[model samples]
Target chain A: MDVGELVDRAREGQPRAVARLISLVEDAHPRLREVAAALTPHTGRARVIGLTGPPGVGKSTSTSMLLSALRAEGKRVGVLAIDPSSPFSGGALLGDRIRMTEHATDPGVFIRSMATRGHLGGLSWATPQAVRVLDAAGFDVVLIETVGVGQSEVDVVKLADTTVVLLAPGLGDGIQAAKAGVLEIADVFVVNKADRDGAETVVRDLKQMIAYARREIRGESWRQPIVRTVAARGEGAQDLVKALSEHHDWLVSHGELERRRAERAADEVAAIALRELQARLTDLHGGGHLPAVAKKVVERELDPYAAADELLAALRAGRG
Target chain B: MDVGELVDRAREGQPRAVARLISLVEDAHPRLREVAAALTPHTGRARVIGLTGPPGVGKSTSTSMLLSALRAEGKRVGVLAIDPSSPFSGGALLGDRIRMTEHATDPGVFIRSMATRGHLGGLSWATPQAVRVLDAAGFDVVLIETVGVGQSEVDVVKLADTTVVLLAPGLGDGIQAAKAGVLEIADVFVVNKADRDGAETVVRDLKQMIAYARREIRGESWRQPIVRTVAARGEGAQDLVKALSEHHDWLVSHGELERRRAERAADEVAAIALRELQARLTDLHGGGHLPAVAKKVVERELDPYAAADELLAALRAGRG
Candidate 1:
């Protein structure tokens, strides 16, 4: 519970302290405010990268490969494997973390798996806070890996300085990626399993889509590069790393990094504000207001918008 | 847009009027409040059924078969095929709607495909409003079919009276469903493509999971029946319909139906209220308040929670 001592230990690169800080973020613990306040001054130094794809895309392998590549540069790396779909704290997804344990004894590598556990907004609300913990803990780079390309996953990736979308053949994921709106969010695309058949097709398809997307964009935009990787064998790791560095440079030069970080902060702040207002709304009339208004709305005595107006008025009156 | 007259026409079962009302909902039109007020009285009568599964599980086929079965019973049916992943309105997913055109001409059947078009909350916010339009249009049943088993899809299913989680052989979806927390939301299980090679295995796997889940429940829980169906061949349509009716009866007899509706209404009202608050927050300082607070947070001068507190105070001051 001594947040200052814990943060000091975390800043000294103590993995246990860093893990505890992130757990606080995940649990939405009451002392989270104190932890955030203690960690704020030391944050914003680490570079964040996000990796996401459909299931069976070898996301963990790609993440592990990236961790090794980043480590070769003598940079401390943090991995947050986020499973938005999993309700258990470490269910099924923790099994994927086993593949990552090759770095368990490495002092510079920290990996953690996060599941939603029925969180209000899934893991999006907690992800940035967890990233802040790692960033403040002095990791040179933080990699966020999400399980699926769902809306929540997209939201998580938006917090990254660079987003790498992985895809392979025979999953029909080339079009699936586009359909899920991954194409717009991807800063770099990795065609993993490059040794497999139809890898060329996935690359070609992504190339065409990226070209098409480029024409629609008005201002200066970084063209998303397609990197072919046989990640299981550690093939193409250097190229992927190089591509990531290039995208990071582009983000910085174009001022997109600052803009993205500020936008993420805004989103985080807004979500917290809404959660606070929601808590106050729930507390109104001893939590009876919602159910009462809901009953009236269900019974056709009121519409939802009017019901919302009444609730807002109650909120104002209570504030007064 | 003559919401009163439109509601009257919709009550008379005019499909055009119903379509217009739903279009207004989808557009988030300014007159949506008027439309909702007009439609409120006629809702609360229709049974809303939600069908969802992984892609290529024959969701469209199952929905088509169910539509046929429901129409054979002389019941008016409305279909809302929601593609939350699609960024374009009715893009790519409209192809699936073509297969349901046979029912398109049936005056008793109303079929519509809704794409999110980058809506703030995906299609979850618009779906209930669209369902209200159908309910007020004198539909006896409304079927909501979503593409994937993502978080947004789960949110959509929570609005349904009976939620059917479909799976097929060879998709490895039995475990995927459990991993995605779909097992907890599904009221019924459909092993579509029942004639396929691995159909029995899927049924057995689901049965085992269902039994495992049943043991975890403390109170009166519906034993989610695993129904086998070759939806593509129109087989098991009657069985599916029978199972739905049984679940409906169980819900009503247990008072769970009223409880679920009330919960859904409360969620709807809260979402509207949150959207209003979000708009007001955005309008503060001519939209510069958020970015300024966000910049401060990004610079680590203030933490996000404190930034949220500042925004909330500004909201109150502006209101006063």
Candidate 2:
């Protein structure tokens, strides 16, 4: 139950310990800083892959296939599915959890789901911390699958080193993908469900889009590839894995991986600091200081901007 | 023009001046604090209404009908269509703009569209400030219409005094509404496109859900109303408006208005402070203070919590 033993067990691939660490992070426990400090030395080894697309695009199936492929290569894999779409939906409805039950008994595979149920500031606050916990737990690869319905996909981009944007054939997905703004965040484009009727058109459209994007991004080093896959049947899984490995190698050789990791760390630090500020502000509210300031603003005696400045000064004064 | 003149003109209900003020807020201009301070006294009069639902639920059409109905009652209205669903989709596709274009020259109506075309923190950060501008511009009713795809609706709840959740019949919208967590947030539920076959079923389902919710929520003051509307034909717009007015009265008489406004001011203050912290952090990054800390964390010499603490200390030192 001690932090030291939990960290030790997590590093030794104990699922219960890993789950506990993540729960501590999610709940923002008092000892969270201790857990992060303890886990820091063992982190930064996992390959974080983000899977995103429009709804019903087989993202979960693709993720499951990728997990199996990586495990076949003798790698320990962890899955973190961030479901921002479902309000009260959990564990059972997530396709990744349901479909990947075949690997439930495999000690090399671990899966966890994080859903947003009215959390302040939502997914961005807790995701990077959860990623760090998984990374420190000695997973060779961590797959992050998020429903690409809204801002969740954008948040996924900040955490994953390699982001694979999934797209299926029909439902006007080509235009939907462009409209949803996933074109810029994709490092590898997977046209899953390629056996469908309009799959070829989706593939063609993606290739053209990527071509135009490459021209627009002249100085960018890595060229994003479009791969076709029937992920449900496991066809083209090996090719997707190969493309991922090639992209990973390119990232390492070009030194972009280090830059990305540094940026991710900076974001994580900022998020943690902001959460701390919010908590401190909440304390001030409970103590009657913030309510008084807000009352003045609401009564038109003070402006919100000036009120915020006063609150910030109080926070600093308290810190001092 | 000077901020004083801009504030004066906006107060006088000049469209250009109001547009300029909102643009300044969207761009986070240097003089935003001044604008906020100036607009403080003129606000708190507008009845802020939020309209939200899933895609293809006729939210925009319903909004248009409501706008016309309010105008018939001699009310000046401002509409902010927060489209978090569409990235590049802006004012043109926003239903309030195109459907309400007949009111383009009506001095009593103003419409603005906000899309997340790569804006940092997106709509939630700027919405409260924008609402203040509209409120101060002498609009009797300010309607905020955000696509209820995900967390946007939750954010809308924080800013609006009356939230009207729209749902059409036969899209399984009843379940969708519950799944989107709108049941807890809806002050008035408007079933748009009620001429459809399953409209009564939708209304019945909503009533049952609300009844169950009321039982679960003991001591809640107000009961949510479900009104049917053929928005395209403007059949039930008056009833919807009446429902909104009743809810607003309830909010005022029950003293929930003050409580809600105070909480809103608190949120606005927190958002402004957080934005300032982010700007300061960006400056630190530019000045090498933050990147140095991030580097230490990335190199495993420092944990992220310690790095955040160091950065916060540097921020305090800068203030000193």
lDDT of 1 by residue, B1-320 (tens): 67799899999988889888888877888899988898888789999999987766888889999999999999999999887552211234566677888887899999998766557555667898999999988899999998653567668877999999888887643454454366777888898999989899888877777777667752566788888999979999999999999999999999999999998998888878877887788786366998899999999899999999999999988887
Clashing pairs for model 1 are none
Stretches of candidate 2 above 4 Å error?
A: A85-97, A176-180, B85-97, B116-122, B172-180
Where's the lowest-lDDT run of ten residues in candidate 2 chain B?
B86-95
lDDT tens per residue, model 1, A1-320:
79999999999999999999988888888898888899999999999999987767889999999999999999999999887562211344566778899999999999988766567655667899999999999999999998653567667877899989888887743554354366767889999999999999888877777777677752456788899998899999999999999999998999999999999899888877877787777786366998999999988899999998999888888888
Using all chains and alpha carbons, the TM-scores for the candidates as numbered come to 0.94, 0.94
> What's the DockQ for every one of the candidates?
0.48, 0.49
Question: Which lDDT tens digits does candidate 2 get at residues B1-320?
Answer: 59888999999999999999999877888898999988998998998999887666788888889999999999999998876653322323543457768878999999987654455546666888899999999999999987666665457655899888888776543554354266767889888888998888888877878887778764688999989899989899889989998999999999998999898888788778777877888888889987888899999999989998998888888988
lDDT of 1 at A67: 93
A136: Cα error in model 2, Å: 1.9
